[model samples]
Target: MNTNSTIRARRIADDIDALAGITEPDRPYTRRAFTPKFLEGRKWLEQAMRDAGAVTQIDAAGNLIGTIRGAHPDLGTIMLGSHSDTVPDGGRFDGIAGVIAALEVVRALRDQGTVLDHTLEVADFLAEEVSIFGVSCIGSRGMSGSRPPEWLQRVAGELTLEQAIADVGGHPLHSAERDDIKAFLELHIEQGPVLQNEKIDIGVVTAIAGITRIEIIVEGRADHAGTTPMGARKDALTTAAWIALGVEELAKALASGEAHFAATVGEFEMTPNAANVVPARVRMLIDARAERREDMERFVDELDNGVGAIAAKTGVAVSAPRMVSDNLPTPGDADLLDVLDGACQTAGASHRRMASGAGHDTAWMARITKAAMIFVPCVDGRSHAPDELATAEDIALGAAVLLDAVMALDTKLQEDI
Candidate 1:
């Protein structure tokens, strides 16, 4: 990395470290979308963007867009950004780190008075977590023209995504789409220990996983635990438990060398939830994932087959109330990958090319723009919890690489356009 780049990145990293109190519990920020805490963070970020000399706007989807104008007005803009709203009790470094790092990039650019030919933007996407709307990529999906109107309106009550956007001064359904913006780049923590475990400082994410969510209900006769004979009673909870383990094993068996497949039963509900009564019905939420679309399909098939078998054997009825599937596997842009790889080498950071098991907003935005992501290591594959962490040195190293990549693109747009 250039001497100037190193100096600039260190300064940026210091500023973010100082903003540590933005969220509590020190490690996980706990700033859910549309909450008062998120509002405060958004206000501070807006001021930061303005102070960096970027023209800022809140889009209809409640996405905060900060732009630095270029000499050429007609060239589409280059977006450097990520979401700030996090999962409940999520790590401070997960999404906030990226937003602040991009802010610092623009800060460095403006402070140095460097002018590029294409406009640059930093976005703080809203409602990335399934809060108030049960939708994951609300901001990016809405901006990309992928969010259905019915889904937005028919999905909920007062906490509709439309209302959330309106609360933030955005009219997504009525606003005209911006014709500019050529590509997008996002910097984020890896959220997994692979890079750290492998002693790599950076990861050029190859693809985002495709996720399938299923809500299963198992129904059996509720009876008095004291009087019902074990052989005569049908236990819904027991049947559901059997299906969950069976699905887990099936996923492991079907996982190929090239495909990463996983099945998890994250939530379980037993009617009455009492120790004395036999559960009449049990509800389970299954989350299955894969990096390949075909692999994900197979996983879902196996899940249904296993659940059916369990129901038949246990004399219980199984049904699915809802199945919501979104986010396809998004491969990173090849040109962006080359630029990022070169940046990592120039910055003298060790990097590995890998596919992300978790989803991010870029997975949705890639459908509309050329997009790729940069990842730094998480200490122990811990995230969405208070214990998630990354060292300052690693954060600084990742930021330096991000600065190099953005600078390269900023200059490349000048010559290409």
Candidate 2:
């Protein structure tokens, strides 16, 4: 790495270490949204942005935006950022790395005494992780005017979503209608093993997978284990287990040749906890995703049919309701992808084009403006866990690519204007 890159890498490592220290004391790194630890972490980040000499503010949706003025403020701004919230007992890097990288880009620009024609804005969005309210991307969705109205009514812990927004100095009803934002770019960890396994330095995301979540319930009669004979008992847990296995089998069968398809029963629960009684009900949460719309549809169809068959064979009443259906795959803007590719080349970082299996704030930002993402490899492709990690060198390389890409976009947008 070059001397500048080495310096930036050290800075990035230091910032991550500092932020990691602001987590829940008992949980180590748990900084869920709207929690005390999460709030403390945001405060630290806001101070860091102000110390970097940028104009900072929290938006109506609780997104913390720090703007650095450019030579020609009339031109639209180039925005970059990610979220700071983490999942329960989550790792240190996932969304936090992106926010720090965006700030690093602004700091680097200041250090070099560089100013572009378009203003630069770095943001740390609120609640990008799945909240207790069963919603994700609340801040980004609010910014793009895509948030569901019911989200405001849902209560998480002691506060409703709306109240949480207000507590953070945000107006939940307000949306940012700024046409001055020309584009958005985010730098994040790959969260998968592909980049590390391939030994690639950078990953230019082409598209984000469409996610579908279904809630499956199997109802059966609760009967005394001794009284109910093995042939007479209707076991809901056994039936739900069959359906879960069926989901895996169907996904594997459909993904035989496709690389971007996945289905998992990540959440499962059973009622009537008694050793002498049969389970009365079983609830399973099914999460499925794919790169293509047709594949997703087919997978859902197969799962539905498989569940029906299992219900018939097990003699249990089964119902699979579509709880969350976000099936539109957001493709990265072509022009922005080209810019990112060029940035990778200029930074001398080995890169490959890949599709993101996980969703990001960029997907919602793409609705408002051109949006793209840069991914750096994490150790063993692990994320959302305590062991999640990325090398300082790799993180710095991704941020360098982001810096180059932002500069390229600034020039390109100016010429277009």
Highest lDDT model number: 2
Q: Return the lDDT, model 1, position 219.
A: 89
Name the lDDT of candidate 1. 0.78
Model 2: per-residue Cα lDDT over 150-265, one tens digit each: 88989877779999998887988777545678999999999999999999999999888888888998999899988888999889999999998998898888677644788899
What TM-scores do the predictions have? 0.90, 0.94
lDDT per residue (tens digit) for residues 1-417 in model 1: 456663355665565654445664543567777777777778878888898898999888789989888877577788887877767676477777778778877876776777777788899887777776776777887777767777657345657666777788678677424557677888888887889889998999888878877898898889899999999888888888898888778778867566666778888989977788898998888787777888877777767777777778888888943576545688899888998999999888888888888888888778777899999887897888777787667767777787788778877766765
Give candidate 2 misplaced runs (Cα > 4 Å): 1-7, 320-323
* Weakest lDDT window of 10 consecutive positions for candidate 1: 18-27
- Per the 3 Å backbone cut-off, how many clashing residue pairs does candidate 1 have? 1
Candidate 1's C-alpha runs over 4 A off are 1-10, 17-20, 23-28, 111-113, 151-160, 320-322, 411-417
Q: What TM-score should be assigned to candidate 2?
A: 0.94
Assess the local accuracy of residue 4 in candidate 2 as a C-alpha lDDT between 0 and 100. Answer: 51
Candidate 1: residue pairs that collide = 77-181
